[model samples]
Target: MNDVVNLAEKLAQFSEHWSPRVVAELNDYQLKVVKLQNSFVWHKHDDTDELFLVLQGAMSIRLRDGDVSLQAGELYVVPRGVEHQPYAEDECHVLLIEPRGVVNTGDAEDTRLRADNDRWI
Candidate 1:
């Protein structure tokens, strides 16, 4: 069986904003897909690095040090234990890379936990 996935097709399967879906896994890491708009809570993953890749639309990562903007075809990594928030003016599709068990809202838990690691595709 083929282990690879078509990113475009995977993204097309969901339309929920801020909810993440699992696309693939590697060792202890996972590849997740999420649609974002508006602002996310400020938080940090104390033990894992977070990666964001813009698949469609635009957004920005607000960090304690500064903010980074991303357009389609762009990507950025938020190192472990860094305080940051993600925001988007309009609908945006993105991919996240992080170790398994990493929560979407980091340590600050709330209603934002749309799906857990096990629910990912």
Candidate 2:
């Protein structure tokens, strides 16, 4: 069985950004960690909502209406079916809480930045 997870330690296991690694699970949701830099694709999940909690640096979620900025310890929820793009000027660490099997790229078929399902750190 797995013991308590150290987020900073888990995050240190990977080098690439924009890809989320599963860290823990609760009921039907998964807690994931990801490193973010530059920009991500514009996409939306029709089946479930996505939660982003910043752990380090800052993040900016670009929506059609406007942009939502988040700093360390801050969070933002992208409601289901809403289009959004995430980016960071510098490297950012974040925790993503969402339902199991939720795709990283949502329903978008851009073929870029598609993370493997159930990947763990």
Candidate 3:
């Protein structure tokens, strides 16, 4: 029999900071969970839009035009081709919904690239 996986349980298994783990999949899209602090690299997905849903804590998105702050239960959509950076003062849990093959770092090829792809908890 298949076991049911709860997101809260899956998130509990991860302790690494700033790394995103795959949690589920819907069609060609992937659902990811990540804990974040400080700031992420400035990048943009030239092909697909990215969605960020705050599960806990708070986050801020820095864009070329301005920045947006997100609290718990808040969500933001970064359109394709728009450069942005994410940051948080305290640790934050977020759910990211995006298309398959979309890199977490976008066009950036830094050490922060999360190699795990499309993995489901």
Candidate 4:
């Protein structure tokens, strides 16, 4: 747990979009890195909020009320139970912060969109 984690280096290890690779853990929460392209399914976490921090390029989180745009070095937190659909025009890198075991697809019924949890880089 004392080893340093490099976001860029880890990001280069994988090219699969929407798959989050666990980078580190803080108490009950985990930090994950993911590559995003196109759009993600609309889903919501009933128990915990999800944080999306843009590491490169740009992305948007579409909510029922409005949409939140984020660029590199920026972040947005989707509150618990708030449905959000993430979209990116081009490939974007993102760092996610959420509770351990929190599903990337949240409550979405489409199993194909769900990513494997606890995958470390």
TM-score per prediction, in order, is 0.90, 0.97, 0.90, 0.98
Any idea what lDDT model 4 has?
0.96
Give the per-residue lDDT of model 2 (tens digit) for 1-121: 2798999999999999988999999988999999999999999999898999999999899999999999999999999999999999999999999998988998788958999979987
Once fitted onto the true fold, the runs of candidate 4 whose alpha carbons sit more than 4 angstroms away are none
Whole-model lDDT for model 3 versus the true structure?
0.85
The positional error of residue 73 in candidate 3, measured at the CA in angstroms, is 0.5
lDDT of 3 by residue, 1-121 (tens): 1456577788899787667787777788888898888989898999999999999999999999999999999999999999999999999999999998777888876756454666555
On the 0 to 100 scale, the lDDT of residue 17 in model 3 is 68
Note the residue pairs that clash in candidate 4: none
Q: What would the per-residue lDDT of candidate 4 be over residues 22-107, giving only the tens digit for each residue? A: 99999999999999999999999999999999999999999999999999999999999999999999999999999999999999
When 2 and 3 are scored with TM-score, the better candidate is: 2
lDDT computed for candidate 1? 0.86
lDDT accuracy of residue 71 in candidate 4: 94
RMSD of each: 1.6, 0.9, 1.9, 0.6
Residue pairs of candidate 3 with colliding backbone atoms: none
What lDDT does candidate 1 reach at residue 20? 84
Using lDDT as the measure, the top candidate is 4
Instruction: Compose the digit string of candidate 1's lDDT tens values, residues 1-121.
Output: 2577888788888887778888888898888888898998888889988999999999999999899999999999999999998999999999998888787888776555435555555
Query: With candidate 4 superimposed using the best TM-score fit, by how many Å does residue 44's alpha carbon deviate from the native?
Result: 0.3
**Which ten residues in a row are the worst by lDDT in model 2?**
103-112
